[model samples]
Target: MSDSDLYATHTVENQPQVLLPYNLWSADRMLVHAVQQNHSDLPTSTLTDFGNIAGDQLMNAGELANKNKPHFQPFDRYGRRIDNVEFHPAYHELMGEAMTAQVHAYSWKNESTTGSHVIRAALLFMHSQADAGTTCPLTMTHAGVAALRNAPDLPRYWADKVISGEYDPRSIPASQKRGITLGMGMTEKQGGSDVRRNTTRADIQADGSYRITGHKFFFSAPMCDAHLILAQSTKGLSCFLLPRILEDGSLNHVRIQRLKDKLGDWSNASSEVEFQGATAHLVGEEGRGVPVIIDMVSLTRLDCMIGSTSLMRQALVQALHHTQHREAFGAKLIEQPLMKNVLADLTLEVAASLALTMRVARAVDLAKANQHEAHLSRIATAIGKYWICKRTPAFVNEAQECLGGIGYVEENILPRLYRQAPLNSIWEGSANVQCLDVLRALRKEPEAINALFVELQKAVGKNSAYDKHIENLKAAFDEQETLEIRSRLLVEQMALALQGALLLNADDKDMAEAFCLARLGKQQGLVFGTLPASVPFDEIIQRGKLEN
Candidate 1:
């Protein structure tokens, strides 16, 4: 009593405990429904297990990894040029579990499955909530398979190891390891997004290989077994696979100049490296680098959408959990009117984000067998990538506001999520790049536009606002000269229309109405908590809450 009254006067009160171990799959009603609606064949037990681990141990590891950022070890005891990046054990723990669960190989390994991409997308969506940094290599490793396909022999030797779901962090030749990861190097200092402006050179050698000499401004995941890099060859820009360690058990000529001090993604390592006559093998024909790398880039862009959506889901859950337990002036925060409105608005965002991204995943899955789906995947990916990523920073910030001061603190997860939100938008390509890609697709591939409209047309008679939005979107496309200047506006409308149509087709009419009212109708506002007063705020908030 003496100690409690003397120094413990400011005891912690009116605060919620850290969110405990919960099943991310079962807790997310919308995700579960989306999986069912998409007709995914992946067993529920798999997701249930990953969801539990992601919510508990993986989340804890994320904190520790971020707190102790990766250390760059460029030399050994004898001052040898090691050029290695070492991470905290927590980072490795997260990677091990993620790889063990087949987060990087599910879609590729289960190519015969109907909804393979959808199932894998769901895994990534949930796993990223635990820690997004490690997913960088996972994404690169997954997407790199696409680019490697251009060289059939490369896949003959690498595909098995890639789809093995074995996590090998050792800096050794791919042949010597149980499994291996692949990364990419594209952007140079002179041109961030313009691959044509790159100055790196690749010279063909007598052994049919090439010697690459230049610097990559952004060499992602330098610790990976190999990286697909673009360099200027005698013919033109070409793609090459540069390994970190040669098969002879010696370090390659690739030198890690330094690691970038990025804003977030602390658990990952991105470096700047110079190729001092690095031995490499071309992936595709010279002068066709853009097309080869574009395949890999498209897959990465899909992951960008997934990562942002995951961040939004995590932020929303954190806000909802905090509000339910924390008290304000006289009542719990969740019971407050304004707070309920904010949560309901975020609920709509998460719902729409998941719907659009999962739908895109299905399109990607079906594209291999259907032409319409292939066109839709090509065009819709750009639209969703541009809009969903553009909306995440604001979404996370509004969720943070529900917790007041605590949300901004480093000890809480919201701060980390906030820092991770912007990376997705800038990673594969910025907003403008995505917008331009949409325009390019529309111009070069008219069938893509037709496919997108056909998909949007399914919800034509469902809602008046949605129908009108579709009409306006179609009319917006008529002005060819203004499309470039108004690309963002056009892409945004496309994204909203796509999300609105998907929601209208969903079983939850109330969620669909709320999304259309807040996003498609005239009642929308610039910030969160602006849904019409007539909407069922408490019902929506209740639907969005996690059971645990």
Candidate 2:
């Protein structure tokens, strides 16, 4: 079949219309194009490595570049054309933890880095296939836990693939390279942030499977081969691994009713999926999916942080390039003090964000290595997710402003970054949810808080920037006397402290400290802003000092 015909075959209009528009072809093209662009910067050796692992035909940069040129006809609802791109089946084999590390590093570079998502999707897809005993190189932390609970030998299977790189998912003819997408199903028609009120239900079947029946208000890649679905199991609110395609390799009973007209990540599909007796395999166990998924969710949260950092970095680079050459008022924009400060601030914050994210990634790696501190790693992940998710959008917005009107145009990547950054915090878990989790984790084991503080103290002792920030944080903590106030202050301090520890561990101690300093300064402003003017500044200072 011709490329056009193949693309046309994937359109949703041709399929039985479910609740949301099902356009796998468009989504596929977007993902393919993004992945193609992602590999553009790689050397031939790396490309060959990817091809060797994937065992499928890998498109080189030249072919990908040719395919990525915007075409008007195959545009999605968002007006973004699908870039015709293809990846070798071995892409999954090539994307192991090291690749994740590389992608994470790239995210630190700038906002235009589209490789993170590609790597992420590849990892998750590989993860699913690996879990099913199909050969794939990628490994996940929760996979072991799930294996212990369900499939005991699964970890060994994963280890062999990772160590030898000899496994091929396509080798199992019955198990093809299936497309996978990750999305949160927390939102409901009634409440979004309040997931406790979610009404999705799962009824048990005689065959030991589940008949999941509920409406997912916002589902990403609903038509993908597999989904990490959230549902209310018999135990409580939980998550399940729901395959879009059944064991018979047919589309499940779930219906995709509508595709959301989102502002950014336009190439990716976000749909409202309605499950009508959809069959699902319970991941982990009953009442255990929430925490289990939360662990997995941390990976995505870290991705969001890194993705935003990458986008901001790209925006800053582009802005700098444009400002350096484009003269305004007979002087380059970078020559002006105001523009120079903006540039400096953008550069600094982007660096800080990158440093913070990498720290989290390293912590995640450490947790995986030592397995004993998995909980601590989860907390660190939350901190990373919360801090970066909150800052990325602001950084993107500020970076866009530096470009003035040009940044708002779709032609420039800033607007897309800006639109996509917010979804990072909202997905995986919102900022508030992360903060609450931090609070809950602290409450569960107060020693974790002290341990975190000690880690920060050690980091501070080594680095001057961190030392200064810690002093400020100590002062802020000392000021709050009420238990309620102390807990809140500690939560904020914990975030800063963890950020410092991660950065220190990641070998970027200075940038992490600077970010904590910025955060401390901002928090002070917020505290001062809310205080009564009649109150003495000294009293406020005194209270802050007391907490430390």
Candidate 3:
């Protein structure tokens, strides 16, 4: 046979099409509407600009960062222990974009506004779609501001650095820079989430600074200028600010042991560190470290929720884009009835996540303003974190499968998304941690439970399916013994109930009906593509598309 004659079938180019110009905010009607209803004060112009950045330059840099994972340089050429974790230029470029977009410091920049939490959450959600790692530094910085204000004298110098929108990546003192970043050093080798079990001890010096002499197994954002760490002081566990560079412009005694070898989040560096009497400043009142750090944890957990939501959205968008382009069995994959059901089902998940998360963000804004929404957020945050993050991996995996074998390859973002999916649930807090927190919320702040119910009750007559879900949730709540033993089940129930409430309250009755029917009414199987034939596959699929 001639060279070109025998392999003619291979010559047909079966290229998978790329998804572009996907304005992360505008693409999701659910997200935009939620922002409008909750944070109307946020300038529409700002959101539009962010949407453009996320879909364009930042989106492109995301792929570049992951493609060139961070590498650790343990020592300098002169054999000094520098322990620098070097990233590609794209990583720094993304960092600059995030800072310029003001996602890292926006809430702090406009803390007095009603849109403080809402805009920050929006920027966070959109940016995480582009780059997951750099967001951690921004998160730490945002959380650090709250912790810093707790200091008796207030560390104005350091706190001001974080709030500044100038994105300086240099390793130097805050005094010499236009802006800076913050990291966290909480977890140690002894305990993961149990910061109280941390053995790092802080000794007070004559100048009122501290000498921290312990190790942090997971020191976030190694490039940051300072870290907020929990260490045992004279009174008890206290919050301390550990600066990388001291006032004298000398490198602090803290030693970066090594960079973590992790499954995902390649763009940012996490390190195991040792503090050899490194100088630090006490942040909050001595021994009130947990509450002070808890302030930070609260916001960080919200960031984690948004992180997972963005991952799921990106994965679904890619799957939707690919299936719309690729053909199989003499038709485009997206046109197949079964595929429509699957895509529509995934759409509901993404929409519900956005709705529920934004609602919680609105509550955060209210809480800051001394509104009753604080009571609701106390409980909702835990439930949202647990259920949403847990739901993410399965959604991402199935969405990846929608693209067939191409989804498994390293070149595509799907594989990276698959790797990053579980990081949110595991980081900040794990499944059991979040579940236990939910259980704690149910017991301690019963008012929060009441608020959740009140929110759900608004949709009582909207849909029979949703009404049934609310009733089932109440019934489950009454069974305290069962709830205690199976907190995950109870928490999951609470989350779905809230989502149902949001959807039913939403103007889009069709999507709401489909979600309630698939998740609450029908006895669907434990997989995607299980939407009942009674559901409007065409309407749901059309509404789900991120592309116009």
Candidate 4:
């Protein structure tokens, strides 16, 4: 079957189905374009080179996945894209590279609005393909690995151009570039988090393909191009790489009858997908799908952590800018001692979140480079995802406090960021679920924790503030005698300290120190059953000044 025929047939067959409102899609596209333009910067030739490679691959894959763009009319009941879909780095190759540069550029002028738009565009494209049943070739499993490895071939076609450090972002037209979108069809409505109980059946067809029949309730990015779907194949509970489009690049049997009215990420279309014998291809071996999918989930969860941290960083930046500029009671808001403390605390939190995110990213990179133990990669990925995902929302909320009334306003980005922040923790895996996984890994491989501790000890040896935090963490670990209690507390404290250290190590050393000290003080108060009677507030203040 030709790709065009397949698309036409699928569209005709699904014509009766409700089409996504076009205005919504247009509004979203407009917002993305505006943001991208607002944030445009001189491309980092080096990063652009890397991006070109990935971009070329995506372009080829997208072309091969020939699908129609579904209209997205951005409007609420009252006709508005109030909850605009913020762009991300994950989708656009150029934008992703741009984000990497932004992190390292250290030039305020390098900050551009385009990165977010590229992400949003990719997400929208995914949604459109999901609605159309076009196969998503940009499998999250391989994509995650590619991202971490910074493999030029992984992003494929544009590899040499991107890696050559001479690619131009402007040369790539927005219309030609595919947008970023994700697929979520993992939850078994009956079994909840237990994939083993998933009864969704996939029977091998005569043509070597499988027909999947079942219902998935909590599917996110259901309308995306590719979905890492879970099902019961012949081997056991497994994952399948199901695309909205078929191999010929046409809509498959997937159907999206309803759109979710989400609490956040509203612009990103999410829906409950019903597969009435949807066509699918088995990923890896049959029974290995679940583990493979879990691996993908771990990496995604890590990305979610970075995303959350990014949100917090953006929120903090906005809040600080507001406070510094906005005056009340005849003084700038930041000048107030209480506000100062709030800003200080927020700064610490944001810094910590950034450090933790970088640490996880590096760990992911290291694991990819070594290619030694899948188990180790899995554990490290889980740890990174769980720790940062849990902390990002908290940081955002605290930062929001700095914005005061403005934070609550819909127009102010904080409220949107705050609402979106919580989704990361819930998605990939919940906090409790991740904690249990951590405990399981620790119990199964005690050496993972020990190895991590050894690394932490090395970090503590440094004279930086993170070293002090590690020292305090070690003190706490040593103080506990009970195996069970100590293990639990140690995990919690270590997660915090490790994240602090990672953040410090990756992005900003000075900010990391400030954050580590702040965390140490907060933790000391909680763990020791009393706040320091006389916190060396002056010392902390002095340290903060020196760091800043």
Candidate 5:
């Protein structure tokens, strides 16, 4: 055969074997290790199963679903105004797998487990490893639990159904579904993060359900049985639960304006919707919309941090896989000193991110029983949401560059991962918003600051580098005059200090030292692979191996 005839054979030889069965969390390392270190009783079997679904089944589904993105349907062929978002079979298949994994409602079902939130974080991190669109609704549902409690009647009403490990996508009332998914519509066009400026109005009705008449600029997963929305009332901004189907078995007056042409996250539907006196149930008090929804927003913000971290880990793993297999300069790529440095630093960066994020997750799991944990979770989520998400885009791009041309193409997941990276930082809330939230927490809730400091203080004496970073962060807090001007700077310092503290407390002394030197010690440059030459590169890189 001619050289061209060997195309298929040649392609096979160069392609790297993928790490599957959720190799990222197949072992109790990194984030999982951090979780087990604190919560020793987390079921080992559940972790293994989650790893299989994410690394194997979900990963396969992710590959196909992203290839076949969802489409918006304005009307049915019979001229019926059935606004629906049509996704490829693979997308639904992936959603089904994710729901079966109970990514949405598992934490609620396992509410008795002390490590429930950490387990949820692990599952969410693993599940989103493939596709993130479906994870959004699940996250909304999970978060909805916290906000749902405000409406005392909602618990018995939604508890069993929301906690059901089933993915019923029927456009029917929540009562009729085998299981139900949840969504949220908060931001409108005029106000992206400034939800207080939302002009949507809600009028009380005789039947107890309010009539919401306005538009939501961005409504995710429109097919969800219900969405918790925000609108203006006589009492000011309030939260309302808007269902797709009203009690009379008729579609609510939710007129789909159009679907958003988002930059990435193609597997889910984000729509612009108009409610013409739509039937909605009031969720908390009349004017407590922002305060009520803040619970849900905080959870989604945590999801954003997890999502960004997942993207970075995937990119790093893919880079590691390619470097280990592909060859150049008469040697294997992994053997190349330059590439090894980059991978090792990436490994440390991702590990530190996972540690800090999981620390928040642990606090979340323990929060219901302990107010201190809750306060720590509140502040940790804000700091992580800002720093980790902001770092994702650059980290993904660096990982992509490691693969050169191949990573830039659609054939590999890097391009898709890169495109998906920015959405997390932008989603739920933007970086600036999170930084300000950190500032707000410090200003209004001194308890939260103390909570955060308590957590950071855990690693204070372990390492001078980490302790110094914490001191720097404390000094920034003291400078209230320039706090706003240096808000981002201060948040960055706080986040880094927190991550540094977590690493310093971690069992992996080498990885911790490397992280402090590269990140906190200022011994590295702006880009990856800038770890100091004296650092032990082999142990760090090997620890990052997907198989390990």
Candidate 6:
């Protein structure tokens, strides 16, 4: 009963320790298995090393970066229009680590390698868990390569810097930098996702360069050296590469209006900008902006799936960690039947998500060489993006609920995760947009539907529940005229079937069966933790938990 006793009226008894310095790769059994299944020559050490950093040091860096948000510096001390966004040192550190790890450059760098997309996807999954904000530039830089290929000269001029695996944060001409990052400026105030309605105009000058005159309502990652933007040319809307600095080392005419105080992603800076006759280089054929940029959009959509999945994984891990240590009603929370049901249900979700995401990554890798794979990648990206992003917010909310009141506090990472959970679903395209894209794919590319069925057929006889689910999906397509109205439901069923098929073929038979039962067999309730009582909760929890 001394001074310390008086201050501590009660000890902090049941609170679990903060989750840090854990191995993200080693602890994620499903991700590890998915990698082994997808890649023939796995970069084991590289992934293991990245997992360690992402789990510990990178997590701390993310906290610091978010706590100290980026500042917009529109003018210099002399009132010169510098138009730069200054970031915390931690954000730069995260960017450097991401670049050095080759998350942005991996697939393109190893284009000929087998399963390159799978490897890169795995890396992105881990990176996003640590800091989702920095992933914006990383994703854009990686996806920009796809758009750059359409312009022959643009690739030679910018490809080297984009794939340099070095992050140059200096706001200077691209030529002077050791490396560079790319950004996008598409949506306008008038047109949110409808790029065709954009008011931006691009006029050809005496030189080959074009002068772009318009404003972008959402100019993401404003500090990027260059952006692939769309503007109206004489022909029609066209894609252009607009740089922040001109070739002669003078700042371009791009004017940064102000930054968007967003709901989340505090570490990244998203700004509204106006290009006042800014010099730009046309990317592809005039009036074909949407077709040309679709390649970049596809890659970014895949990243959306990966990012959301990462958020779910981290949230589930946090929940498991909490329940394992915390106690109530004279027993550990993990041992409680209801909580175990919730935890096990979440475990199955993460496993199925990893399986489906990795499977799509493999499809992307093989797309160039195989026609079926190409079609599958086209359709599956939309489905995965739609479903995974849609599920993340609720998944994170459930995880937050596991920790009760403490989880809502700012001091914990759960609050940040909860805020970030909905961003991926809204970023690339909202749920409705994704569903429409899937319908468009079905109408335009018949081969895409065939490819999807071919993939689902791989596990046809593995489980009766999965087989029945596939049959139901096939039957739903007969009502083609109603697809647009019921697009969300159609896409969701397609997604669940894909996940069920992947899990059925995976190594863990029991886990696969449980997924089929709960997700497909109608043995579960509407929300998570509704798995049938027969499911082995203890084994599933053990499989998913991080060892303390």
**On residues 1-548, what C-alpha lDDT tens digit does candidate 3 reach at each position?**
98779767765455565666667777776567767757766677777788888888888898899888889887789998776778999898888888887888788788777778888888888899898877888888888888888886745767787777888877777789888888999999998998889899999999888899989999988878888999999899999888887777778888888888889998889999999999998887899899999888888888888889989888888888898888888898999989988998898898889888888888887886654588788888988999899999899999989988889998788998999998989988898999988888778888878888888888899888888887777787766777778888888888888898888887888888888888888657888889888888778777667756
Write down the lDDT that model 4 would get: 0.49
Report the C-alpha lDDT of model 4 over 472-506, residue by residue, as the tens digit.
66576444345444454555676776656454444
Name the best candidate (by lDDT).
6
Report every candidate's CA lDDT: 0.90, 0.49, 0.85, 0.49, 0.83, 0.91
Model 1 error, position 536 (Å): 1.3
Number of clashing pairs per prediction, in order? 0, 23, 0, 40, 3, 0
Candidates' RMSD to native: 1.2, 14.6, 2.0, 15.4, 2.1, 1.2
List candidate 1 segments past 4 Å from native: 1-7
Candidate 1 has its poorest 10 consecutive residues by lDDT at 151-160
Give candidate 1's error at residue 480 in angstroms: 1.3
Root-mean-square deviation of Cα positions for candidate 1 versus the true structure, in angstroms: 1.2
Kindly list the per-residue Cα lDDT of model 5 for residues 247-289, writing each as its tens digit. Answer: 5778889998888888888888889999998988888898999
Q: Distance from true position, residue 251, model 3, in Å?
A: 1.1
**Model 4: residues >4 Å from true position, as ranges?**
1-43, 46-182, 247-250, 371-377, 462-490, 500-513, 521-548
Query: Ten residues in a row with the worst lDDT in model 4?
Result: 129-138
lDDT for model 3, on a 0 to 1 scale?
Answer: 0.85
Residues 243-294, candidate 6: write the lDDT tens digits: 8888799988999999999999999999999989999998989899998899
Q: Per-residue error at 506 for model 1, in Å?
A: 0.7
